[model samples]
Target: MSKIKVGVIGCGSIAKHRHLPEYANNNNVEIIAVCDIVKERVSEIAKEYQAIAYTDYEELLANPEVDAVSVCTPNYLHAPISIAALQAGKHVLCEKPMATSIKDAEQMIEAAKESNKKLMIAHNQRFVPSHQKARQLIEKGEVGKIYSFRTAFGHGGPEGWSADGVNSWFFKKEQAYIGALGDLGVHKTDLLRFILGEEFTDVGAFVETSSKENADVDDTAVCVLKTESGIIGTLAASWSYVSKEDNSTIIYGENAILRLEDDPVNSLVVQYKNGEVVKYELGGIQTNDAGGQTNTQVIDQFVSALIENTEPVVNGEEGYKSLKVVLAALQSSETRQITSL
Candidate 1:
């Protein structure tokens, strides 16, 4: 494929801020079409990119020119659209929290396998400058024999970001299925698995809707997770942090303690038991208030993988594994007992 032709489904915040702009800017990609249920919004985006507009996603998928698609629809539509795209002989790059349930995730993966197309998940945290640096240090045994860790992701709420504002599908249970646990916590779940290079085996949590009004989904979640190697950690996700966004992680090891996103000035910091401190002044993490643009390498990698005919880092298996931890946490919250995977 000389140039990968791309189609974007769902003209929401994620598409407007990340997918469309990134695809238009990628020299190796051509924006062939844009789709959304909203006619006005989709037409505007299509005109901006000088491409075709589609109100139904099926029409976009049927086009022979589109070689790939970005699944940026509501949480519930992620799996179905991804599966359909794959079956249509197009590669897929899906958003986080791949699906509402494990069965749907499995079906999506199978569809990709049957069609022999790439299926990548948008787990952008793995591409953050600070996050990449931290992973290298951990892999090099800089944090020897990890004991415990804590990671959290919190923000004001989706009302200020979503295209629909307070009436966005994010606030609806039927559309979103789960709340903070899926939106915010799933990112941390995927990030932790990437940085630690381990799978969570047990999950115990408290997921609740503590803030906001007139919505049924949860607003906050606190989870206790145990990895396969017996590494214990706590993960908290929330939409009630009235303050600024919080995306931070701390890891304690026998030789040192590593911190990430905990400091705005020094994004990645390491302190050894010998009383030595080192800091890396990487740029700020991408946030919603800053237009939610993605410069974290996800788009570039997705394009590269498609052009080179290779599997991306956050493929279906990796995405499914990360999503399992989040789903387990939700189950734990309901059963009031630890869930094991």
Candidate 2:
């Protein structure tokens, strides 16, 4: 196919603000359809993009013209929609946290393998320049051996991003499955995994609905992780930060200490044990909260992977692995003990 015909399933804030716009920007993609349970939302996005609209995702998947799909639905629906899309012979780019449970994520992976279709999860932080640079440094042995690290992602709350404001699906435990951990924590979990290139072996955490008045989900969460390579660290995620702090990993290695943060300019600060401290400031790659240019970069990579017949940078398996860390952390929080991954 000269241009990949794509369908977007889910017309929520993520679809409208991130996925659709990024897909629209890619010249090699032709958005053929949009689907959402809410007819008005689907119609609005469809009209905006000049594409057909459907209330049911299955109908959209059945369209012969659609070669790929962006599964922008809620946490619970991710697995079923992605699996069905792959079964319908369409490549899938599902949103992060893969699914609410490991079983569902495995099913999605199995569907992709069975259909021989690509299944990529949208872990956009992996595409950020600063994060990429950090990975490069680690791979090149510039930091020697990673010992421990800290990462975090925080914001005002879901009310600002959700279409329903205070009554959003993010607050509904049944819909979101978990609270701050799934929404913001997963990103850090994925990022730590990506940067460290190591799997977490155990996790201990504390989670609570500390600030949100009536929300059933957690507003704040903190976790400690032990990697298979003997590295240990902490990850913090919150939807209650009055002033957002998108700070992240401070990797201490034998040779250097690397500090990464997303404020005053995205940057990676490295302090060598030899007394050399270098700070590389990356002008924000994309819009901050929306993950701006990184979203487009990730989508471009996914499409390129399809055309090249190669594996995606953040495939279903990788998404599942990252999600396992979050799941272990949640289990740790609930049990007040270290949970094995």
Candidate 3:
């Protein structure tokens, strides 16, 4: 195949803002079709990209022209749509949180294995330049003996990002399953694991819906996590920050502290115990702003993995593990006790 013919399932905000534009920029990809339950959304996106439109995703998967698919649907539809696409002999690039539950995530992974097709999770934070650099630094032991950290991802809410605005499925429990925790928390879970090179073994959480009227899902979550290596940290996800998004991490170690995405000018900063301070001017994290150059290398990475027949950095199993941490947090909150992963 000279170029990968791609079908995008769900022409929602993510497709319109991230996946579609990135695929268009990749010369190795040719978008063959678009599917969405919303006819207007699918039609407009398909016309703009010169691809076939379908309201049903199964119809799009049945198109033999499509060699791969980007599943940008709601959390509830992720596993089923991805499994069907894989079964239809197409590679899948699924959005984060993998599925609403581990059972569904495992099922999707099993389907991918049965089909012998690539299955990558779109954990875009893992593709961020600063995050990549941070991982490199941590692996090199720049901060000796990691002790604790605090990471958070917060914004006004999904209303600003969802195509449906206030009425987006993000606030509905049936479609979203969980709110800020699933939407933003899982990203942090994946990122912290990537950065620290550790797996969380236990979690204690306080999840609540402090804001967003009529939202049945949690709008805020604060979790205390312990890693396998005994490192402790706090993970917070919130939709209450109305003014600006806070996507920052502070890693405290025996030697120094590393700050990530905390400053506007410098994406990374390190403070040594010897009183030496270093700042790195990496790029800014991508936001809802439309005109800036996108930093999410997810599309490019997914295409490369497909072409090279290699595993993506954030594959199905990786997504499943990160989601386990998020789910553990929810369980801990409900039971009022620490949950073991």
Q: Each prediction's Cα lDDT score?
A: 0.92, 0.87, 0.92
Residue runs of model 1 more than 4 Å from their true location after superposition = none
Q: Write the residue-wise lDDT of candidate 1 on 110-204 in tens digits.
A: 99999999999999999999889988988998889898999999999889898999998999999999888889899999999999989899999
Per-residue lDDT, model 3, residue 95, is: 91
TM-score of each: 0.98, 0.96, 0.98
User: Candidate 1, overall lDDT?
Assistant: 0.92
How many steric overlaps does candidate 2 have?
2
* Tens digits of lDDT, candidate 3, 1-341: 69999999999888888899999999999998999989887889989999999998888888998999999998999999999999999999999878999999999999999999999999988877788888888889888999999999999998888889999999999999989999999999999999999999999999999999979999999999999999999999999999878999999998889999999889999999999999999888887653435748999999999999998889999999999999999999999999999
lDDT of 2 by residue, 125-170 (tens): 8887788899999999989988899888887888888776898888
